[model samples]
Target: MITAQNLTKRFGAHTAVDDVSFTIKPGQVTGFLGPNGAGKSTTMRMIMGLDRPTHGSTTVNGRPFGEHTDPMRQAGALLDAKAAHPGRRAADHLRLLAATNGIARSRVDDVLELTGIASVARRRIGGFSLGMHQRLGIAATMLGDPEVLIFDEPVNGLDPEGVHWVRGFAKARAAEGRTVFISSHLMSEMAQTADHIIVLGKGRVLADAPIAQFLGGAGQERTRVRVSDATVLGSILSADGVSITQTDAESLEIAGLPPAHIARRAALENLDLHELTPLNASLEEAYLALTDDATEYRSDRTAVAA
Candidate 1:
């Protein structure tokens, strides 16, 4: 277990984390989410004791990270997958970490096997691809068989299969009663994997809730309607509780009306309907809506492209 209590950090005058608090428990995968400048990496650094917080504190289990005996054996962190010495051999790197922590040398090979990097263990890390580097990072994190694991953007450079593998691996670790905390900007990927979510914006915690609650962000129900004569059918259904928007010449995006009521209304008006589907607010849509104000730099690129 890990708890961040009013964790705040500042660089000079700019406050990065703004009194954030959260608990990550074992036996569940918790996803940490925020936009690019939302202070996620800084928070992770504080948790790993790499960055001194300007105020407040974070702890693993019940003790501050700096106070933990055999810190690597207690909590493993991968802040950046490629944050390794480029000249070091992968196997030697793992061995050095294991040696420093008094973890068994055999554990190095075990993690190598666990992360599927045994074949390339002797290769220089500089020659490794991003996917291979991710594998090495995971191998390093598992060197001590730590009970708490933190991964920041673990899936950033992986292919689809690699993404699936990491998702499964994180879930498996949590199943063994170990805490797994993952941070990523991909909401759809997180929605498929995380049991709970913590959303951040403007260096503050915007929302913290279960995955279901977080995924349901500020959007009303929408229904898709298809008809052969969309013009006539849309006018017929546009009576009171329905505002029909043309999806195409033949399809209608209808909202504020139940499917059954829409069908009944269509039937009474003798309309030819073909399809009816509800367009729920997906995790991606929710994330976009949540960060609408934070995307300042994008407007410039969009305008230039326009």
Candidate 2:
């Protein structure tokens, strides 16, 4: 398990992580979520002993990361997939890391095969694709067969098949009682992969809870309605304390009102309804709503004349 005690990190006057505290338990996959510049990377760096926290502490398996005699055997991370030497062969890269921690050279081939990159293991790193690089990085992380694994954006450059493989692999690892923590912007994947979630905003811990609880509560239910006149339906729903977003000419997504209420309103107004569907609140929607205020780089885009 990984634990953080009021973890705080500051660079000069700029604080990156602020009094954040949480525990990542074993036998479960925990997701780390945050908006850009919300200090997700900084916190992970501190846990890996790459960055010194200005205050507080973090530990892997009950002791500081630096104090571990065999750090690779305790915890392994894949923060940067392209951090390997570009000139080295893929297998050579894993061999180098394994040598540092007294791991057998045979383990290098094992991980390469496990990651499905064994065919390309003899190729130079510089010639690998983005997805191949990610595979190699994952292979290196598993070189020591650590009990704790942390992956940052593991699916960033992967194809659909690769993404599916990672989701299954992470869950399989957790089922084996390993501590698995992953950070990703792909909320849909996280929704499927993680059992629990920890959200950070503005360098503070916004929430830490099970996936179901985190996506539940207020503003959880939203419905989509398809009518002959979406504009009129939107106006009617808006006046009744419902928020409406016109998706297209015939469809409007309504929030703050149940599907039954919407159907009743449509019947009362003699509105021609084609469809009235209850839309599930997705993890993407929840993340955007929770971190709307914490987003660092806000965009203001407007249509331009052709």
The CA lDDT of each predicted structure is 0.87, 0.90
Given candidate 1, what's the lDDT at residue 244? 76
| Candidate number achieving the greatest lDDT relative to the actual structure | 2
Predicted structure 1, TM vs. truth: 0.86
Report the lDDT tens digits of candidate 2 across residue range 239-298: 656678998999999888889988888888899999998866678888888898888877
Worst 10 residues of 1 by lDDT: 292-301
lDDT of 1 by residue, 71-118 (tens): 988899998888889999999989999888999999989999999889
Off by over 4 Å in 1: 225-233, 236-242, 246-252, 258-277, 301-305
Model 1 lDDT vs. the true structure? 0.87
Which sections of candidate 2 miss by over 4 Å?
A: 218-279, 301-306
Return the lDDT, model 1, position 237.
69
